[model samples]
Target: MRYVLGIDGGGSKTVCILMNDARQVIGRSEAGSSNYQSIGIAATLKSIQSAICSAVTSTVKIEAICLGLAGVGRAADIENVKVLVQELQNSQLLPIIWDLQPSNIVICNDALIALVGGVGHDVGIVAAVGTGSIIFGRNHQGKTKRVGGWGYILGDEGSAYKIAIAGLQAALKSYDGREISTSLVENFKQHLSLASIEDLIEVIYRQGWKVKEIAALAPIVDLAAASGDEVANKIIDNAAEELIKATSTVINAIFSQNSGLEVITTGSVWRGSSKIHERFTASIINEFPHAKVIFPRFEPAYGAGLLALQRLTR
Candidate 1:
């Protein structure tokens, strides 16, 4: 039986799945982050190799492998990933042999895999919002468009980090009587175990909180919004509107207004209790009536496996 390997590597983790010709997943494993741009090439290679080694139980020659990684958009970044994959193929730690041709190796950004896996097809839009946000869409004509994804420094509108920052800002403003009252002040204080709102300065700056750490506090805002906190709800509304705007841009760029397509929502931000997903879906549907908004149908690793399998046919 022909076999293929699919890998979904991102900033947080790497996932590997072994699938056969019949599209049956035989083995699966995970490792640490493999975003070479963030964790460096050597570490990324090691993580990929480790996940591959753990996923392949039997001694089998793999036909193809697809790696969908984060921060791999630019041509230079793609080439760098190609070199990293080449290094992985030459590694001695893997148990199985890869009988890969140049066409058998598929490398792409994580967004594409999310699109493929979310809808069980390659043609759709994926609005991913985590600590960062990006909107990517591909039509049947093979044309694609992307919005946002500039990271936290420049962009990342409608993302969890942005939401958390907004919440914090509102809390401080309310404390100083510069803005309307918000439950966010108490929520943040309780969630972080801070003695006062002023202590947040030390917690954020002095304690060295990273993007992920800050993003984790987004649930506080979400919960407050769910409980009918006006400011928190406004923050959620703004986030939904931003995502809607980004999604609308992608729909208009590559998809006709009447084109029936899926717009998949991926990542932690959509999982919030504030009903942001519903808000986004309603707004998108209201704007582009033919668009179907959805969550992922399968994990990205499965989509990578499908892409790897497609290489054999091509």
Candidate 2:
């Protein structure tokens, strides 16, 4: 019996699942963040191998594998990752060498699998907010468009990273007396273990700032927003608005109908807070009055496995 393995290589973590030819899941595993661009290629490959091995260990030796990974936009990078995985599989001496795409790999940008998770058919959009964010969709004519994903430095609007940045800006503005904000001074000090903005500047200039490390404060922002911190509320509201704006851009590009189009959203950000989801949904409906927002019925790995099955059946 042929067995297929699927992976969703996300920035926060990696999810791997093994399935039989009949499409029954046999094993599963989780690994560290898999964004090759962010974590470096070596770490990403290690995490990918660990996840795949854990999920394929007990039963169903993998005959094929499909991976939807981050930082796979460039052809050179894709080939490098394929070699890395193949080399690992060989070093352990586990299985016969096989064509990487069919036996061990199918590289894809993270957005595509999220889109697959949203709609089984590749004819709709998925806008997601996580540690970072991006919007991806394909139309009926096999045309695809994407916006964002340049990372926290240049893009990633509406992401946890963005939220954290906005919160920081608001806090600075409050300190400067330029805006009236519920004092996040204490929260920032506590969160970053710093007593002064000088400390923040040191980290940003002398010590090299890690935006994602600050982004870890996003949950705190969410809590503050929920507790009625006006500035915090505004930051999150703006994030939600931008996320919807991304959805609208894709829908407008592909679906030019008066009744709107199929739009689905799924991610850790939407999963955590119903209030945020409600606000985001309200923003979406304002633009696409007839657009339907469906929660992902399956994890992205399941969708990748289904895609493999689709290939097999054809």
**Per-residue alpha-carbon lDDT of candidate 1 for residues 1-314, written as tens digits (9 for 90 to 100):** 89999999999899999999788999999999998898898999899999998999778899999999998888998888889878877887788787999889999999988888888878999999999999999999989999999999999999999999999999999999999999999989988899999999999999999999999989999999999999999999999999999999999999988889998899899999999999998888898889899889999999999999988877
* Clashing residue pairs for model 2: none
Error of 1 at 126 (Å): 0.7
**Model 2: ten consecutive residues of lowest lDDT:** 94-103
lDDT of 1: 0.92
- For all predictions, the C-alpha RMSD in Å is 1.0, 3.1
Please give, for residues 1-314, the per-residue lDDT of candidate 2 as tens digits.
67777788877899987777787787778999988877888898788778877876653355566778877888897887777667665756333234334434567777877777667655678887887888888887878989887888889998888887787778778888897866566688787799784577776667776776777767767777888888988888888878888878888887765744566677667764427888878877776787777787667887677666555555
The candidate maximizing TM-score is 1
Q: Scored by CA lDDT, what does every candidate get?
A: 0.92, 0.75
Error of model 1, residue 35, in angstroms = 1.4
Candidate 1 ranges with C-alpha deviation above 4 Å: none
- Backbone clashes counted, model 1: 0
TM-score of each: 0.98, 0.85
